[model samples]
Target: MTASTDLLATFVARYPAQPATAFWRGIEIEQLARAFASDGVGLDLGCGDGILTDILFKRIGVTPRLIGVDIDPLETEAAAAYSFYDRIHTIPAQAIPEPDASIDYVISNSVLEHIPDLEGVIAEVGRLLKPGGRFYFTVPAPGFHRNLRGSILPGVSRERYLADLDKRLAHFHYLSAADWRAMSARHGLALDSATGYLDGKETRRWEHLSRMTGGLLHSLSFGKSRPIEIQRALRIRDLQNRMALPAPVASGIAKMIACPDAPDSDDIQSCLLVTGHRPRD
Candidate 1:
């Protein structure tokens, strides 16, 4: 095998999956490890289950003083298992458990899209970041719906498909570059950089496969929570972290993965990553 193929195979093997869905997203993030490097303290917002962040850092080979914050007690306990973060806090988005001007960097991965009050999160991110501190996040564009049209729901009405997705994913907004600039400006943050990833065709493939696998999981679990999701037990959580496999599924008109390796070429891409900073006056 050529060097690139060998690398890809190694990547795919290292980040194995049980449901085998969204495997591409992990590969995509690992490719952008350099951009995620941090110098001082760092925080992860909405750190669901924390497996992805753990896996990503392992790939990047950097273990900075990272703190994880999530609202779900289940997720916060799970976050401790990977031992990826130096500290993990369970709190609301409005209440980050950190002092002002203390954090050097913050990352919100695949999280901003699901929030109902986009402005509040932006405002709080501004509050937590130190001057010149950066926040890197990923959100899908408005055109994401196009991928869902024939891929996830064929013979279904547009209205129905959209409603189903919004309900299933609990999503509120999808933003373009213009939206990012406006929101960042309103929240006292400046756009440092941005890039998009996952083309329409590739996004459709990811979405289609995700739904199929999720359905299989739901049926297999029989609507009961899996024990490996042991929020009350740390030892079991750390040992069986593999249960966090398959990665969380995503549904939208557009799908985007966060990868700094991708070039900023297309506006109509599946996912966009925006790096914002608090500029000193």
Candidate 2:
């Protein structure tokens, strides 16, 4: 197996039940079912494990000619397990295997943030879609915290938080709601609808503290008893407690004043669900 395929296989092995992955897949399937109820071809870009593809097939019942593409052969192999798809293609995001304007609708869920060349991928999406075709996709909004810092402080440097963001440029890109609108407009696409959510600083801090505490606990149990690790363990636990203590007390107060139009409480950040269409002649 190639190195790329091997790495993805290891990832799947470690987190076979990727809850976040399943959540995004369900979201995509629901959106697609509502938009395209009839039989029509669709493409699932970066179709890891084919969970979303399976959901689309079962829910839509359109028997739409499905094509799933991924760079990782292992993921492609996993995707192939879903017999519903008419074909499974493995190729880089910059260069899809299919010809231009080949599909009716394109579903890109949580895939753009990882791509380094955002413009290139957007152009490719344009190429793949028929005139007036719909593109339903979601990207990570700015201010996404993955528990790197012990707490979410005001004015955190974007550079530090997204240090690895550059590495996955080929796979994703982080953009704000306004930025996404401008991008789609530039690419000759019109926005249909959008949604946003609030990612309060407190909630982010709590998540960070939880991860740090978990990591420190694992290291202390397994790693050497270095002085640094000892200090870090104590520090992480303290931060965890400080950030987690007042969540319940403040929950009621937050609800009374929270924005009504904001996305469901379950949403992690200010995500914008955008549906764009290519203008017809």
Candidate 3:
């Protein structure tokens, strides 16, 4: 199997109950793995449960000096199981415990959009990074809402549906690449690259799968901060964790979820992979 296929298979096997998340994350992890530095003192911003980071490190086949941080203690408690991170801190993004210029890189995967205090977090990123330190993150584009299949559903108002969808996802920002560049510039992080990924069709498929895979129900019952809490309350994640599919069945399902779009596609993109760096001087 190709590397991309292998990644998808891994996620599918691990997250049999969250196939939509696994599918989307498989694509995302492949992109991150390709660019992530194998050596350095790195921080994983908003690293949830450390599952994705664990998978990423396994794929990269390295044990770098990495730290995981998140606001959710439950998630961090779960994250503590991963040996990949040197330390795990449960803290708000704006007040990371590390000293200034202490980190060689920071990665926040699909995380920044949910932060209302984005400027504060970016400012924190600027303060923590060493000279020439890199920052990598991914987020949905502004066009993501416009591309959703539900936006075009008969009898539904596109604006209302899109608005409700954003609220459901707890997304606060859908900035364009230019917007990211401008924001990074203000924070002293030079925009090295902003590449598009996950085209419109793939995005629509993702939306459909999310709803079909109980994501919509989770969204309805719990807000962004409540996912881990609710899951723990009901022990739903525990049950899901035990319900693994056979390898062949999981592979087939993963293939069905995988999109044909290259990790960085030029088509009307639904998401972005942005990279920037602090100036050496």
Candidate 4:
């Protein structure tokens, strides 16, 4: 393999499996299985690493003809071992490599945040799903928690971070539950459900610490001091993350912080679970 390809392969090989990643994999698989009956063809958009694809195959046992699509060739290469995908398509988020109305179910998880043209992607997802087919996905909710470093520094002055945040959030456009509902309506889809995933307070605490440390490191030039320093920082981050609270507990704390004013029934902040359906003729 070429040097660049070999480097990517090594990175993929060393990528550790984390609890949070496993939780989302389970969520996506369960959502897809619940949405479709046996023998249904499904499309996994932005199927990075194919973890969710494998989960769907093992849990559902339907052997649903699966098509995995991603923009990253390296991720697709790493996903080759899953063997659940009947085919893999490398395509941009705004355009899918599938015939119109060809898929019975469409699923995306934590992928929408990275796409610049979300509306175009939504339109493409709509075009790809057959009538009555469902789309299940998640997106970060709009709040301080949705800010670039919101999960890293809760106590920093908003003004201090706003400029830096603007640059980061530029790559991500989080929507409120209402915003998603309206977006779905505009695209001839009905919002079936919306649920939050983090408490507000917890999100703020995580963001506060993360941002403070990150800012200090940036200002001290630690991030660029040397290749060794960069590697050291990465190691520390991995250790800190591993030592963090369990997913359920972290999620609970995030909801409390993010939804302080929220009603009892709606108390999540960071992630939102959304399901929608295309209108039938």
Candidate 5:
């Protein structure tokens, strides 16, 4: 994958069930691939379904000794189907079943924001990492809700819409770059870098695509109280996933939805990539 088009196509093929998510992940997955190594023992914190890790490792062309963990049994069960993770555990983020300083690295993709007790998880990461081991995570910036493109309909409240959307997405935290740095330091991890991605334009595009693809189901399922079950029971997810397209066709669709603006300005970003490392001392 030389350009964004190739990365987007990969996600489009794997995540046929959620084209919007694919569009979003297309950018995130690429950013993530460049931020880490392809070897060593890594723990996928909150590894939902394992598609992201699988695609990420494929992009890197190396499969490390990877372990996946999730609080939800259903998600862990689904993640077990993928060969990316050597082991899958259904456990709380605060309580991973691993020895202290045993892991070489820890990665959590878009999972930290949904966690209410983020401090506990970060502390766990510090404890689990072999000193000098890194912790890589992605979360929405404070601008996430502000960057959204809500309904243009008359009498539509953007605040109301965004709040509802956040609830539906189960987002609990929208931390600033500085906030992440401070949190990392508190957990004995030095903040290495914090970069922004998913600009305002692309965030808006994602919102549009999500509404077009999963709006009805979200409404019917009462803000996705049981989105997986609903999608499975209706066979909507199965049908969507089954329609994976060839690379060329997927690329074409991705190009159409691709956002041209780059996330150069930090203030306008909808998401952030934060990396920190434990001190070797």
Candidate 6:
């Protein structure tokens, strides 16, 4: 099999049934890593569970001095088993434990959407990165919430249920590419590139199934096994075999599957990959 096919096979083996949207998100990050990865120190911001990072770098065939940080100790503990990160920190993204201007590269995978104080996090990213360092991330676009199940109700105003939905989904902001560029610019970072990912058809399916699955899990667990249901939905199938797989010999998994637009597509989906570089003094 080609390298991309091999990567997909490994992904399928690792996460046999991950949610369509999330699985694709990981794949997209793998693609971004091809350009954004550096051999110097790397930090994974909001690195919940660290599963994606573990698989991502392996697929890309490089391992820097990656540190994983998040606010959840439970998830961090789970992440510890993988050995993908040299160290891990449990702290708020805005209060990263790393020294100022020390990290060489920083990456966040599908993490920015959940942070409410987005500016604080952006500022912190700037503080942690060395001059000319880059921060690469993926987040829901402005259109994410539009087709979301909670954002549209037949009779009730979306405002009525939006808060509740955001809480359940851990979604705080779905920003535009322009918004990301502006936010990063304020933090002494320049927009490297920004582009949308995932097409509308897939996005609608993803959102619909996300709510549908969550509703089912709540019902099936007698509303008590919510945690397990969440994990299952996110496709954390194995607990013990956290060993890294050697990267496959081929690539292009992300471009072929997740990236719906190179630069010219007009259909609105839900997510965008944003890269910001810290300007050299």
Cα lDDT tens digits for candidate 3, 1-281: 02377788888887776777787788777777787763589999998877778788888788767889999887788778777789988999999989999999999999999999999999999999999899989888887876777744578787777777777678899989999999998888898888877767677678888776555566667545434355567676665444556779888988888775544343677778899899988
Per-residue lDDT over 121-237 for candidate 4, one digit per residue giving the tens place of the 0 to 100 score = 888888888888888886667753443343235777756566554343343777877988898887778898876654454344435433444444544673345322442456743
Off by over 4 Å in 3: 1-3, 151-154, 215-230, 239-246, 260-266
Give each model's whole-structure lDDT. Answer: 0.63, 0.55, 0.79, 0.59, 0.81, 0.68
lDDT tens per residue, model 1, 86-121: 888888787776788888888887788878877888
Error of 1 at 165 (Å): 1.8
Considering summed lDDT, which 10 consecutive residues are worst modelled in model 6?
246-255
Ranking by lDDT: 5, 3, 6, 1, 4, 2
Which candidate model has the greater TM-score, 2 or 5? 5
lDDT of 6: 0.68
The TM-score measured for candidate 5 stands at 0.91
1-281: candidate 2 lDDT, tens digit per residue: 01122222222222222322322333334554555532467788888766555545556565557788787775677678676667888887777888887778887766777666888778788788888788877665654544224324476576643543233223255576678778878877777766543244433432343334433443455544432245345564234222332434334323332223433344445344567777775
Ranking by TM-score: 5, 3, 6, 1, 4, 2
Compared to the true structure, candidate 6 yields what TM-score?
A: 0.77
Task: Name the TM-score of candidate 2.
Answer: 0.61
**Alpha-carbon RMSD of each model:** 6.9, 12.0, 3.1, 9.6, 2.5, 5.4
Cα error of candidate 2 at position 113, Å: 0.5
The estimated TM-scores of all candidates read: 0.76, 0.61, 0.89, 0.64, 0.91, 0.77
Model 2, C-alpha of 260: deviation from truth (Å): 17
